[model samples]
Target: MRAVTWALALWLALLGGAAHGAGRGSAAEAQAMVGKAVLYLQQHGRQKALEEFNRPQGQFRDRDLYLAVFDLQGNGLAHLNPRLVGKATGDIRDADGKAIFQAQRALALEKGRGWVDYKWPNPQSGKVEQKSTWLEKSGDLIIMCGIYQ
Candidate 1:
């Protein structure tokens, strides 16, 4: 009886962990996050918006999905990673050597909003994976959010 109970408990724990890990955000959710961030920027202003976006624990962050913002000059204005906040991310490339930030900049400047796909390390999964980022131009900044595919 003790052995059976222990096995059932372990099974339940494993099942719960799997269910918790399955809640990745969708593409639509990523797009919606971008829009919501834009609205927050408009209402609360840039400084506040950046603070919220850069915060690791906030409404803008969900599972592996979070907001990333860059200045017109390609400097990281807001990101969950503190090290990336003030650095130039435009020169960063993907696993395939694709210019990630340059493509994002071009799309935002030319079309004012669009999707850019690249291979990046998913923070939650700790693996390099395909991702689609939806971005928009908001004043002097470009707001973005992405989903792992």
Candidate 2:
């Protein structure tokens, strides 16, 4: 009985550790994906990176997370959403009337890399929710990937 109880306790502890690790996994993966996209832009150049980013089934896209590249002036250069590509987003705002694109551009230009939060419609839920984007500047453009909160 004692041995059995000890075994059960060990198993539960291992299971708990695994569950905690899984939650951290997704956040780390999102950051890794963004970092890889930045590297791709540096090595392959913007034109090639944009081509890849715009591809429907390209590596820059994965599940609910994908890369969106914009010029410093808020013009959408490459986006996962087909409608947003090639759009002039200088005055684009979030659901709450926050100028999200401008804020993103400012963060990228000032800090060169950081996270910006705003309200957006989640593609998975189709409902507006708090979302955050990790932003980094690559030469004349800003590279970003967002996660819905």
Candidate 3:
């Protein structure tokens, strides 16, 4: 009985830790990541920066928060989804039927940097959840990083 209790406690602690680490990123972190990626892009050029941004475990990727870049025309230059890259993605809608990329593009065009909220399926929870991305316009590129709420 004593050993069983100890094992249960350990399992619960590990589960909590996993949940905490999974969504550790915040809105501020997303903004900062976009800024960092812009700097990296200017320093490294497009091809190299795209490779780094697309890297699953690269510097631009922090847990679920990862960098994605799209052109002003809504063509994905670097995205988590390889299929979206080099294609028009502005028409993609959220579960709620919101034109997410169009909204994001408006923010980039008008404000140059801001947050856009949408809903996405959380793979871990297997349910839809709120997500917000901080995006910045870097010349023709719209760089972004999102935090799961």
Judged by TM-score, which candidate is best?
Answer: 1
The digit string of per-residue lDDT tens for model 2 on 1-149 reads 13643353345345542432432223334566779988988899888989998898898776677888899888898887788888998898898899998888888878998777778886766789766677788889888887665
Give residue 28's lDDT in candidate 3 (0 to 100): 57
Tens-digit lDDT track of model 1 for 29-119: 6778999999999999988989899887889998888999999888999887788899988899999999999999998989998778889
The predicted structure with the larger lDDT, 2 or 3, is 3
Residue 16 C-alpha lDDT in model 3 = 45
Estimate, for each residue in 9-106, the C-alpha lDDT of model 3 and write its tens digit: 34534554343355566555666789899999999998899999988778987766788899988898887768888899989999999898999999
Q: Which one is best on lDDT?
A: 1
User: All predictions: root-mean-square deviation over Cα?
Assistant: 11.4, 10.4, 10.4
| Deviation (Å) of 23 in candidate 1 | 2.1
- Candidate 3 collision pairs: none
Which ranges of candidate 2 are over 4 A from the true structure?
1-25
